[model samples]
Target: MIVLHNVQKKLGMRPVLRHIHMEVKKGECLSIVGPNGAGKTTLLKVCACIHQIDAGSMYWNGQDVYKQLTEYKRNLGWISHHHFLYENFTPVENLRFYSELYGVKNCEETIKRWLKIVDLYVFKDIPVRTFSKGMKQRLSLARALLHEPSILLLDEPFTGLDQDGVQLLFHLLQQEKEKQTAIMMVTHDFSHIEKISNKVIFLHKGEIAAESVQTEEKHIKEMYKTLVDER
Candidate 1:
C-alpha cells in the first residue's frame, strides 16, 4: 500500500538516503536493517510523508503522499525511538485524550482493551515518566493502535526492552499482520527479524543494498550475517 520512487534525501550537503525505490504490499510487514548512520530513519520519514524528498516521490494506495500530506497521514501511525508520551500525564489520561483527538468510537472500551493487551492496565493512573522503558514501550504500542491505522511506521521499537518485552512485541506484530496492517519497522539486527518481519531490506550509504523475501528462506539471522560479511 506504500510506494517510494527513486527517492532521495539530504541534510544540507550530507546525503541521508538516495535512489530508494521500495514498495510495501498491502498487509505486509517489512523491516529495514542496517548499521548506524545507514539512513534507515531518514528513509522511513520520507515514506511516511513526514520529511520532504529532494528527488522522486512517495505514494500511499495510488495517492501522492507529499501532495496531500495531512489527509494521507490520518491513515498512518508512528512510533519513534524517542519517548512519545507526556511526562506529567497518567497513562489513562494520555490514552483518553488521544482517543478523543482521533474521534474514536467506543473510546473508553478501546483504550481499556489496548491497555490490557500491553499489560499496562494496572498502572493506568501512573505518570508515564515514572515508568520503566519497557513500560513506556508497551504504552506506546497501545497508543499506536489507538486510531486503528492501516499503516504503521516504527523506529527502533526494541531499543528499551528486555527479552520478555521483545517477545511481547513480536506477538503484537503477529496480531497486526493478522489484521492486515502494513507495518514498516527499523531494526538493528537479524536475530529477531525472522519472527517479526516478512521482508528484510538492508540500507547502506543511503541506498538499498539488498532485499530478501521471507518465502522459504526464513533464515533471517543467517542472511543478515551474510550481508554483513559481504560488506
Candidate 2:
C-alpha cells in the first residue's frame, strides 16, 4: 500500500500540488481526473518519486519513501505520455536492456511472454522507430510490467491506443489487479477502465474537489462533469 499525507509540491515559484492526501492499497485502482493544469500529472510524478514533495510525506507500506528511496523505487512501475523507449532498439532489445537493469534472471522467457501478452511478439525484433504510436505505447506498457512491481503510476495510458490495443491494456490491467498491484492512473477518459477502478478523485487547482468510492461510477461521472463544467 501507498499513502500520501498532506503532500505538497511546487514548480519553481508556483505551487502545483497542495495538501494532497490519498491511499492506494494492493489490488486497488485509483483514477485521478481533472482539467488541464490541474496537477494530475504532477501528483502521479510525486507518487512515482519522480518529483519530490516540498512538504508532507509519502509512505510505501508504512515506510517513509525518502528513508528508503532505492528499496521503495524497486517496487514501483511508472508510465507517462512519452514512450521512454530507445527508438533505435527493437522491442526485444528494449525489454532485454530493462530486464538486465532490473537484474531479472531467466528474463529470456519472461520477455517473450510479455511481448506475446502485448501482442507485439511478431514485431519484437523490429526497431521501435518504425512502429506506430499505438504499437509503441504497447511496447512501453510491456516494459512497465516487466518487473511485476507492486505499484503502477500511469499518465494517460489510453491516449494513442486503438480498440484492440485498448482491450489488451485492459486485459493486462485486470491481470495486474489480480496480482494485487496498486494502480494510480491519470486520465480524462475513464469509460474504458472505470469498471476496474476502486476510487476516483476529481481534482481542481491541485486539490481534490470531489471523491467517490468504488461502485459510485455514476456519482463520479456526475461530479466530474460538474467540476469540469464549473471551471
Candidate 3:
C-alpha cells in the first residue's frame, strides 16, 4: 500500500499540492480529476518521486519513502505527458535500454512480450521517430511495464490514442490491477475511470474538493463540474 499524509509541494514558491492526503491499496485504482492548473500532474509527479515534497510524508507499506528512496523508486512506474523514449531508437532498443538500466532478467523476452501486449511487435524494429503519437504512447506503456513495478503513476494515459490503443490500455491496466499493482492516474475520461477505479478524487486549486468510493462516471463528472464552478 501507498499512503500520503498531509503532503505539500511548491513550484517556485507557488503551492502546487496543498496538504494533500490519500491512500491506495494493492490491487486498487485511484483516479484524480480536476480542471486545468489544479495540480493533478504535479500530484502524480510527487507520488512518482520526480518532485520532492516540501512537507508531509509518503510511505510504501510501512517504510518511509524518503528514507528508503532508492528502494522506493524501484517499485514505481511513471508515465506523464512526456513519453521519455529516445526517438532515434527502435521500440525494441528502447525497451532493452530501460530493462538493462532496471537490471531486469530475461530482458529480451520481457521486451518482446510487452511489445506484443501493446500491439507494437510488428513495428518493434522501427525507430520511435517514425512512429505516430499513438504508437509512441503504446511504446511508452510497454517501457513502463517492462520492470513489473508495483505502483503506476499515470497522467493522461489515454492521450493521442486510437480506439484500439485505448482498449489495449484498458486491458493492460486490468491485468495489472489483477496482479495487485497499485495505480494512480490523472485523466478527464470518466468512462474508463468508472470501469477501473475504486476511488475518485476531485481537486480544485491544489485541494481535494470531494472524494467518492465506487461512484458512477456520470456522478463523478457532475461532481467535478460543480466543484470547478464553485472555484
Candidate 4:
C-alpha cells in the first residue's frame, strides 16, 4: 500500500536520506531501526508526506502522493512524539474534538471503544496534561486510531511506555494488522517485530542498508551493531 521510488532528501547542504526504496503491503507491519542521525525519522516523514522529498517520487496505494495530498493523507494514521490532544481537555473531550475534525460518523461509539481498548476508560474524564507519560501515550494511540486509517506510521511508539502499557499497545496493533491495516514503525527496540512486523527495514548512512522478512531473530539490533562497527 506504500511505495518509494529512488527517494532522496537533504537538510540544507547535508544529505539525510539517499535514494531509498521500500514497500509495505496491506496487513504488513514494517519496522525501521537505525542509529541516531541515520535518517529513520526523515524517511518516515517523507512517507507520511509531512516533509517534501527532494528527488524521485512517492506513491500511496497507486496515486502519486504530491498529486493527491488530501486524499492520500486521509488514508493514514500517524503517531509521533508530539501529542495533538489538548492538555486542558479530558480524554473523552479530546477524542470527541478530533472525531468532529475528521468528520467521523460514529464519534461517541468510537470514543468509548478506543478508551476501553487502551484501558483508559476510568480516566476518561480526567484532563490529559495530568496524565503520566504512559497514560498520555495510550491516549495518543487512541486518537490516531479513531478514524481507522489504512496505514499507520509510528515514530518511537514505545517511548515513555511502561512494560504493561507496551504490551497492551502491541496487542492493539496486532488487531489492526489482522484487519489489514498497513503499518510502518520507526523504533529503536526490536522486541515487537517478531509479533507485529512482516518485514524489517534497516537504515544506515542515510540509506536502506538491509531489508529482510521477519524471522525468529529480530536481527536489526545485532546487524546494526556489526554494520556500524565495520564502518
lDDT of each: 0.83, 0.88, 0.91, 0.86
Candidate 2: tens digits of C-alpha lDDT, residues 1-231? 999999999999999998998899999999998889999999998987889999998999899999999887887888777998999999999999999977777899999999998899999889999999999999999899898889999999987899998888888888999999999998877674466788888889999887888535566677878888887
Give the deviation of candidate 2 from the true structure as CA RMSD.
1.4
lDDT of 4 by residue, 1-231 (tens): 889999999999999999898888888899988789999999989888888999988887787989999887887888887877799999999999988877788899999999998889999999998999888888999999899889899998888889888898788889889989989998866776676778887788898888878433536567767878876
Best by TM-score: 3
* TM-scores for candidates 1 onward, in order: 0.92, 0.96, 0.97, 0.95
Q: What total of clashing residue pairs does each candidate reach? A: 0, 0, 0, 0
Q: Residue 176 CA error for candidate 3 (Å)?
A: 0.7
Once model 3 is optimally superposed onto the true structure by TM-score, how far is the C-alpha of residue 104 displaced, in angstroms? 0.9
Which pairs of residues clash in candidate 4, taking residues 3 or more apart in a chain or in different chains?
none
Model 3 regions lying over 4 Å from their true place: none
TM-score of model 4 vs. true structure: 0.95
Ranking by TM-score: 3, 2, 4, 1
TM-score (C-alpha, index-matched) for candidate 1 = 0.92
Residues 43-89, candidate 3: write the lDDT tens digits: 99898888999999999997889999988788889776689999999
lDDT of 1: 0.83
Candidate 2 at residue 196, lDDT?
70
- For candidate 1, the C-alpha RMSD (Å) to the true structure equals 2.0
Lowest lDDT block of 10, candidate 3: 72-81
